[model samples]
Target: MDELKIPNVVCKIEVYAAVNPSEDPDKVRLAVSHVILETDYQYKEGSIKATSNQLNSLVKIQETIKKHRTNKIYRRQMRFNTKGDTTWFYLNKQAAFVDVIAACEEAEESAMGPIKVILHSKDLDKVVDWLAPEMTE
Candidate 1:
């Protein structure tokens, strides 16, 4: 995808899930807040099922990844959800936050499931680098 058309700000991107049409916004936002806090999301029994791309959370994520950009990193796609009003691509949380400094080399994969990182075609590189930087010595 062309990288020139992607958005740098998190609010500009979008995400969705197969949530009940009658789901409450406050509930959804609250559920999303949990994911944002833990830096991961997973559907459990009776757990809130919602789709979100909350702006402040996303901005904090962007900043956190930038803060850890200098460390050795791994980037892996956790899952590929179907597209609706928005295209959603989930990523491993370790790719965005954890530092596997004991690996001796960059980890090729991660088990930190369900942290979604929304990427635009135009700004793909910027986003990837933000989350998992391709650095040099």
Candidate 2:
């Protein structure tokens, strides 16, 4: 009989609502926060490599956000370049972080829903560790 050994690894997750409360706070803030934190911890302990596309996507998002804020008065509603509000970042094949910015925006539109979220980290393991303490046992 052969004995099987299980690999030891821990996953951590953190959920955050990316909406700015000042814009239009909503009740979904707590829900969205929990989701982001939970997801963050779940994928924290994985081996994933940051890809150029993911990095580029993050940069573009940030730039767009900056532009949006800069010309705030011109646009009545916040708009994202992506078709929907959801944007995701991948580390190799696995997603390191998922930004729910659109979700947050939608939440706001619905009278305080959830704001969008951004997940990012070079070391997935570390992120999980950071989030672990915040979760309920």
Candidate 3:
């Protein structure tokens, strides 16, 4: 008999500055704060970045995009220059972290743009399982 092992999923959280530079600084700061708090992503003046392999952090990233109304890119498809096994999904942005985790438990497809999740399609199931283990109600 053979045993299967789940390999670690590597995903990156890439946040591009979608807002116009002329946009209100306070709003932008507030928006960026949510991202920073949730993902602990370092903020850049124009566009910022971060990466995480942790499931909870990833869930936090998605929820931030969904909840931040000033987040212009929320629920929009990621503008990846290319696509392959990797599917960059944006959470339509929130319900609850657990709810999103639960949805990931079932659906292969995710909402478009913000809450940007860049991952390989091959890794989707593995990533979801890693994020949310099956639970009994």
| Candidate with best TM-score | 3
Say which prediction, candidate 1 or candidate 3, comes out ahead on lDDT: 3
lDDT of 1 by residue, 31-90 (tens): 355334333444444343333443444444444444565323334331123233223344
What is the C-alpha lDDT profile of model 3 across 53-75, one tens digit per residue?
A: 44445555444433443223322
Candidate 2 residues 27-95, lDDT tens each?
233333322332222112221111221322233333333434422321212223222322222111011
Which should have the higher lDDT, number 2 or number 3?
3
TM-scores for the candidates: 0.36, 0.21, 0.40
Superposed model 3: Cα runs more than 4 Å off = 1-8, 24-26, 32-45, 61-82, 91-115, 120-122, 128-137
Candidate 1 clash pair list: 3-122, 4-122, 5-122, 6-122
Better of 1 and 2 by TM-score: 1
Instruction: Report how far off residue 64 is in candidate 3 (Å).
Output: 9.9
For candidate 3, which ten residues in a row score worst on lDDT?
101-110
What C-alpha lDDT values do all the predictions have?
0.38, 0.28, 0.40
Query: What would you estimate as the lDDT of candidate 3?
Result: 0.40
Instruction: Report residue 108 deviation for candidate 1 (angstroms).
Output: 21
Q: Residue 20's C-alpha lDDT in candidate 1?
A: 38
Pairs in steric clash, model 3: 66-93, 75-112, 76-112, 76-113, 77-113
Q: Considering every candidate listed, which one attains the maximal lDDT?
A: 3
